[model samples]
Target: MDSKIVQVALNGLENILRLGEQESKQNGMGINPYCALIEEAYGLDKIEFLQSHENQEIYQKAFDLIEHYFGVEDDDPSVVPQVDENQQQFVFQQQEAPMEGFQL
Candidate 1:
């Protein structure tokens, strides 16, 4: 896919995740389901890939997402976290139903 497209998708994902995190906290959920979705989708892989993107804005957005979710600095290689074919199917299964309310 085009880098711009990927960047836009990542930005949207980050926004949703950040918003979900805030709302979940307010609701006392203690965990962000959107973070789980990102994990299931191997979001860290995309972050790693985008780190080398020639576009500075893209890399910055990726880094910001990382920092927000992991509470880690950009130089922290340990926190950056993958999916496979079977896992892809499992992710799809989990996403089959749209979330109706604040329930995870």
Candidate 2:
């Protein structure tokens, strides 16, 4: 799996856990077991364990849970803003052109 994808998934899990923890604090309660397990699975040692095929399932489950909680479906191009090719070309042209009052 791509590291960027993994990082994003982990971030989602962390965000959910943090929110739950905050809510628990407000209610005068300790962190929940589900959050604790998820946090533990995201630890460095657990990440290393994910390198193995057997442990990959655990990571996948965690990612799936995070995605479900965050309401994130698979990647959708519509969700990401894209720059027009013409716009990028225009920007490049502007940068290549000499400025009126500045030396390059």
Worst 10 residues of 2 by lDDT: 89-98
Q: All candidates' lDDT scores? A: 0.75, 0.56
Model 1 residue runs over 4 Å out of place are 72-104
Could you give candidate 2's per-residue lDDT for residues 1-104 as a string of tens digits? 57567657666756766688678778887544445565566654454454452445556755554444433356875455555687673222233665576767
lDDT of 1 by residue, 35-59 (tens): 7787788877777788788888888
Candidate RMSDs in Å, in order, are 15.8, 11.2
What is the Cα root-mean-square deviation between model 1 and the actual structure? Answer: 15.8
Clashes (N, CA, C under 3 Å) per candidate:
0, 0
